[model samples]
Target: MSETAARAGWVEITCEGELREVVGGPNRHAAHKTRTALHALDRAWLAHSPLCFIATSDGDGSCDVSPKGDPPGFVKVLDDTTLAIPDRPGNKRVDGFTNILRNPRVGLAFLLPGRGDTLRVNGRARIVRQAPFLDGMTVRGHRPALALVVEVEEVFHHCAKAFLRSGTWDPDTWAPQALPSRARIAKALDRPDDTLEFLEEYYGPGYAERLYG
Candidate 1:
């Protein structure tokens, strides 16, 4: 490459002397102050999803990625711009919840297992300990650790490309064996007691009871 082109900040060299393109991606869509996208969680979408990704970040830039899952429809759609969900019992790290306290920004992506498409929601959130929905929710005859109230900003239909490329829904490409054993994963997480055996012993019954009832 010419010295003139190399002098531009768009190119750089790594410690291994590998030349790299620093930044050359087309710009994304402009942010709309008032979103025209769908702002509601449809019952069908929430009813079919088995997992959701939650992203939250503190004011200081400390971020947390959390995975939420259950039978289905744990998230309740209140209206076109609102949703609620009871936070079930767990390890109690509360990283996502705490981040919401100091920062209102929150993002959610819901995926239906074996389905290519997903739902995405961006919004501000707050911890809601007492809500009408929480009134009847009980796990093992105990109330949820907490409930989350999300005020929707924008909701969009996420394409299936990521899932297709990752073979997320393809049973033939599934690698249940490649995953670490439950006990080993818990050990690496510094919670040897967090065995699947233990979680199953506790959550399995509670999840079924609360979900069905």
Candidate 2:
């Protein structure tokens, strides 16, 4: 078969009607759960959340999703319609931040350990390098150099079906050793020039000491 002919065997739904026909529409409560500003319950959830994933896309629609995490309550609730997430030490790629500069729209999903549900927020984001709030975001005497402030446009509580189906919080379902260790993978793919022994040492127990440095 020709390449185009072979691809014709796959069926794709390109319109809302076709897509909805397959999955069905959400019920009234599911369809109307979104809120434009944070509620008291939402604030409580954010206070207890230690991690979240931020999703962004550049002007050209190129995308990136990055994870941000810290001790519980790391994300600050600035107001009913605003939130601030501290930027911590990481690989320095800043792919999401770059995308935010090009396109302010962003989405976030906040997760709590052992919880099946998540809090979702969609908003406009701006990168702030200097702010009085940055001082209060400090941890272990290390203050963040920047933060991403989000003006919440929509916020909602997502259902836990995805997590429940995946057994995410079930300890018995975990198999972390099913894959190679971080050091071994880094040596194999990212740092081919470095010796395996060196990479292992670099990602060893002492690695935690450099987390704030």
Please give the CA lDDT of all the candidate structures. Answer: 0.74, 0.96
By lDDT, the best candidate is 2
Candidate 2 lands at a TM-score of 0.96
Per-prediction TM-score, please? Answer: 0.71, 0.96
The most accurate candidate by TM-score is 2
**Worst-scoring 10-residue span by lDDT in model 1:** 30-39
Model 1 lDDT per residue over 87-171, tens place: 8766678999889889999999988877787788899898887777876556446666577878888777766888889987788
Q: Superposing every Cα of model 2 onto the true structure, what RMSD results?
A: 1.4
The superposed Cα distance between candidate 2 and the true structure at residue 153, in angstroms, equals 0.3
**Residue 125 lDDT in model 1?**
92
